[model samples]
Target: MAAGIEHGRRSRPNIRIIAWAGAAALLLVPLVAMQVTQEVAWDVTDFAFFGGLLLSVGGAYELLVRASGNATYRAAAAIALAGVFLLVWVNAAVGIIGSEADNANLLFAGVIATGVAGACLARLQPRGMARALVATALAQALVGMVALMGRLGVMSSAWPGDIFAATGFFAGLWLLSAWLFGRAARA
Candidate 1:
């Protein structure tokens, strides 16, 4: 019994690492695509968005895991990530951040939020981390789907090309997350 417990303890970190690595790989897809396309197909900001999305997803996973472990931490990390997503959506909607403009400020905010979320998760529920990771990834995927639909000229009036582009990128991230989470849950 003690050996079984000890073995379980040793495997937790590996699980987290694997999940993180999967998330990281999903995040890198756009970057790799852009590089391979010679930057002619996609802009640098496109890659940046994927990077930010990865950070946000990874952070959420960490936060959920942390919260699961330490019931005292007050689920603020997850809430904060939600807020960041809202901010991005609002800013993008109001035209405060142009579709084509490379806005580092927004990206920076996202990064910070992700970092906080990750730290919180690391401290909290490391075991149930997959659920949180999946949730974040799903959110991103939804955003991507909306964007893809727009790009396909589905919602021309409501979402502009830029919005569609952003959404499409996130959608890819989320899909990857879903796969990872599903796999981890099964294992």
Candidate 2:
């Protein structure tokens, strides 16, 4: 009750519940669809992979809330985490540059690796986190540059601006997270 304490502790169980329920519910959606349509066919590995991914995201969120009380810090962390989650999901399911099997799409891993490495180097501090996110954004943009320049992947349809748009969107998210982390550091 002294000063500037967040209700993060109180929200811990709530987040855990949400994560758990979310993972189950999301996994169920595909399972249900599979029964109704052949188009939705998914193996056990797919279910396991996604189930693990959802839970991991939730766990990361829980840890972040436990580690920092600043709401801005929490928000920044959430953005970064969600960005990674969405990147992985979309890349695995549909591919970033072409399709899921596109060799160019594999480059997205660099963005993730940069984020993880930067986070480790920064030790998750607000200022360092900002830098990490910036690096992440750069990595994302670099992949786009590389893929587009090299014409690296096969596309089912003719390539439009999809590659440009996808990379830009993800890079923007990384920058947004970086900006929030910067604000948190200043605070």
Candidate 3:
């Protein structure tokens, strides 16, 4: 009985496996879509890059969630991870501020960088994650404001609507994450 129980525990799939599988499924969606529609076009490099990115980010988040004892910390980490993944994926798929190659879109990376630096500084503590989340939220807002300025004719972008939409979506996610983290910290 003891041996069977231990074997069962060892055989169960871990969080890493689940994360990788989920990431693979997400990447496969576009690959399958490309077969039926011309709207989804991805080269080998794009597939590999995005696949690797999703897997890496998902695995990292899974590890963080599993290793943390605090529920609040786990929630904060998950929010931050999701925000980073979405921002990067959106920017890589199409330019947030303009075309995919638009220089203004690069500014959004600062938000992710801020989160990473905060994680390092806070050592992944709940309080630190809260502060980091707020900082990232601020960074996202700044990026959105820049995109809004472009929409107002302050920058060069024919697709100001796209810029506004992307910025608004991502900034909202950042703000939500910040709010969650703040609540966690307070609790």
lDDT scores in order = 0.48, 0.86, 0.75
- Summarize candidate 3's per-residue lDDT along 62-122 as a digit string, tens digits: 6677656667667767777887888888788766776667777788879889988987898
Cα lDDT tens digits for candidate 2, 35-99 = 99999989999999998898888888887777778999999999999999999999899887777
Q: Using TM-score, rank the candidates from best to worst.
A: 2, 3, 1
lDDT of 3: 0.75
Q: Output the better candidate (1/2) by lDDT.
A: 2
TM-score of 2: 0.87
Writing each residue's lDDT as its tens digit, candidate 1 over 24-100 gives 78766656776777744646775577567667656765756654443222233334344455446445434322432
Model 1 weakest lDDT span, ten residues long: 70-79
- Single out the weakest 10-residue window by summed lDDT for candidate 2: 2-11
Clashing pairs in 3: none
Residue runs of model 3 more than 4 Å from their true location after superposition: 1-16, 150-159
**lDDT at 41 for candidate 3?**
87
